[model samples]
Target: MTRQRYHHGDLRRALLSAAAEAIAESGVNSLSMRDLARRAGVSHAAPGHHFADKAGLLTALATDGFQQLAKALGTSRLASNSLLELGVTYLRFALAHRGTFEVMFRTDLYHAADPDLLAARQRAADALYAGMADLPDAPAVASEEVREVALAAWSMVHGFATLWLSGAFPDSAAEDPVEAARVILGRVFTLHAGVIPSPEAS
Candidate 1:
């Protein structure tokens, strides 16, 4: 039987959603406009009307990923364990949207300077900074100091997520990535927060 053609009112949304699924299942390198068109049941040329090229499509996906990440980070609260909670949320977002997360950081795959991508990225960054500033014991620090801490925290969480996704952990301790991430991230940030962590605990 012939596949039903895409005749929806919002082809843009449909194409984006399809592209996301395609990337998640096949990785960013395998995503293509033609494949997305077929996935969405639209003519191969239909994607062109919405996205000029694959770069445009991936740029849009990256923009969407950052916006969603900002929301995830924004709503994450600091119960007594501030860094652990915030870092967990960051890891969750990456693991949940593995495809978009992969494309969002690979500057070589997408237009890194796209205006929408920049705005979304800024919001995500701002959310992290705000999360750091809200820590209970966090002092009345300079913005620069807060910025430095935020960058470090982001690096640590991003590194953990990237490494976990790459299966870089060993079984003796990494039998569970989530638990391992929580312990590893909590310990590392606890140290950064001026608490002397016992290496054995880590």
Candidate 2:
């Protein structure tokens, strides 16, 4: 008997979800279109209907990953609290969604030139920086100062997460990497002000 195909609403999302899982389990290099379709409980052609190929699927995943990450980072209401919170959230998301996180940042795996994907990635970064505006005395800092601070913070958290995920950290390090990231980021950003311009007196 011929197997029935899925036609339910939101098949695209379902496929992406399945694809993320597959990537997480075996890495992007091992993921295949047929594998995704199998995991999604759909016919092989169904994935093609939504995403023409593996590259297309990866592009969509990257776009979706950025949008979701932006939302996660922006969930904190207080702007003053956003920077640290966003960094924590970023590390948490990466640790939890390793597959999606890896593909989202690897431009070579996806069609990064796609306008929608590029825009989504930009929006993610913009949201992160916007949170910085909530700083108590940010405007007084020069543009370069802000960039320098932001890059430094990004580097610290990004490096920590990468090292933890890559198994470069000591086993004795706390298993909860997110907590470690928060503590480290807090210490780093707090002292970072001294490195930047002091706000002018009111």
Candidate 3:
């Protein structure tokens, strides 16, 4: 019998990449350390060295998801752009990275309280808000105020993505999720006093 070596090139990243695909195809509930190791062509214990247990692996996955999301949302555009574009991007990420998106928000599985995980999550959220803060229509308020706005923005996009992913949205919506998300989120972004004002309201 041949023994597998632990010293593998980019083992952590390899495992994460494979796990992401597995989670995308089969929910995290279907993922196992041994299965991941087999997919990675490594020993079962190899994953433990990087992630102590299932929760640990999930934490790492969530952390990485946050980092990637932050990067995607962090791109700087015009000096005074609309957050609607950022919202579109967020929805796009969820569609593109379905697996990571699922784990990142599923607090039931991943430990949101873990310091490392918490910090990563916060950083990702902060990155999104920071982009919003630079928007032309950004409210002139405290950080928390902007955060609230960010949350509202996030909810619209996240909701649209979730519905789309779950196939709850009609096939017509899938025909153009981005445009659909944009229209739905545009209303949420611009609506006020239970009414979406005309462009002349500015």
Candidate 4:
């Protein structure tokens, strides 16, 4: 394939976009800087100029994914202020950005200790936890109880997204993932209504 030339500052973005496409088509294991360069219409070395290696590229991709996820969650929180809505948004992000979602959690695939990656991951986490606190029944202050509730909520949504993406759901449930997720997540919140005991109760 003929190499395509990239503008002065477009190569990095082009390479990242190509890498996502390649991961979606094949898998992370099959992705290579050389292949990404070809897909982006640049010299093989072009990718290296931006990303030192495969891990570097994947790290950058994961960072971008986390930032995007955080923004989506923040938007949902503002528009609906509903925990269920936040959970649904999480699922939607995962399915829509399958390639990035697949790479985001696989620590073995990238430099897990990278500062930017860690910061981005924290931003996404904070968004989810903030939604929990926005709930009407949330604790009055940030405490161990609040953290526990947030963790449970995160686990449930994250698990559902992972399972859905891996094709683990049957045809019936898979037909409408958003609705299915809504029902499932709704029940979870309902089951744990008033999860954090009120001050009056204590």
Candidate 5:
């Protein structure tokens, strides 16, 4: 049977929507353009119009992920915001878009050299780096230390999200991943001028 486009006439959106659902159901490595077309109720060749190939579709998804992540990181940001908030927000974004979040970092799955992808990636990185100002003892405009702390913060949240989504934490040990993430991040990082009990004390 032949498939047809959505009545709203947004084939690209429809295909991307289907791809996201498919990725969530399976994974990026398992996503197929033909499968996406079928899910979107479009003809087999319909997805080809907006994307050249599977790489093209994945590239689009990765790009979208980065742009949205940047926005997420930028939301209600302030010098008063703690590393805990930033890290929590990062985890939230990851949990919300598990599939795109997965593909955004795994360059092996998509075209890492794509110009748009590179720009969007940088935007997301910049957003993450924005959290540097929250470091308690970092010097003002400390570019090197900011970069280091930013890397540490990113690593902390990234690692926590990866593990939580993998079901590494058992329900008996810790049921709420977000709270667990907050508690863990709270111990490791703090905001400027904000005081919290040391991890050892908690």
Candidate 6:
């Protein structure tokens, strides 16, 4: 591969972009720092300069993914003001950022204890919990109850996205993932509504 020079700050970004593309095309197990440097048109040691090793690169990628997810959820919440819409947005992000999505949750692939990664993950969690708080009919529940509801909502969307990505769904569902998700989420929300106590009861 021809070695191309990148401006000081650009090298890190370029290598990260290449890593995401590589992981998306051939899963994380097949990814290598040498291949990433080659893909980025840089010296073999270039990626190492920015990321000490493959784990470091993945940690950076996962951190970015969580940050992006948090922003997407926050924007959806502000714009639509609906937990249902937030779920849809979450699915959309998972579909659109397949490479990052694949790595973000796999703790073994990255440095799970990295401060930046932890902070980013927390931001995403906070955003999801905030969405639960905004539900129109949702009453003022205890923190534990709120956490449980948030987890349920997160599980629903994350499970659906993971299954869809792995081709677990039929062709018909794949053809219109957004609509498919809307239908599934609607049912989940409907069932969920029965469990949450009314404001008067709360």
Using lDDT as the measure, the top candidate is 6
Give the TM-score comparing model 2 with the true structure, all chains together: 0.84
Candidate 3 lDDT over 1-202, as tens digits, reads 1123346447777778878899999988899999998988888887887888888888888998888887777763342266778878888889888888889989988777989888888878877777555576544456557778777667777888888888897675438888887787777666622344656675
User: Where is the poorest 10-residue window by lDDT in model 4?
Assistant: 1-10
TM-score of 3: 0.83
What tens digits encode model 5's per-residue C-alpha lDDT throughout 1-202? 2233455467887777778788888988799988998887777888878999998888999999899988888873554355677788889888888888878888887899999999998998888787566544432455667887778778978999988877786772556778887777776665422355555567
- Which ranges in model 5 have alpha carbons more than 4 Å from their true place? 1-9, 134-141, 172-174, 190-202
Per-candidate clashes come to 0, 0, 0, 1, 0, 0
In order, candidate lDDTs are 0.79, 0.76, 0.77, 0.84, 0.77, 0.85
Candidate 5 similarity to native, TM-score? 0.84
| Model 6's TM-score against the true structure | 0.89
lDDT of 2 at 87: 77
- Candidate 2: where are CA atoms >4 Å away? 1-5, 77-80, 131-133, 136-140, 172-174, 195-202
TM-score of each: 0.86, 0.84, 0.83, 0.88, 0.84, 0.89
lDDT of 1 by residue, 1-202 (tens): 1133335447877777888889789888788888987887778888888789999988888999999999888888534436677888999898888888888888898899888899999999888888466686343456669988778878988999888887676662546667887888877776666567556656
**Tens-digit lDDT track for model 2 on 63-136?**
99999987877775354365677778778888888889889879999898999998898887876676464565
**C-alpha RMSD (angstroms) for model 5:** 3.7
**Candidate structures ordered by lDDT, highest first:** 6, 4, 1, 5, 3, 2
Error of 3 at 62 (Å): 0.4
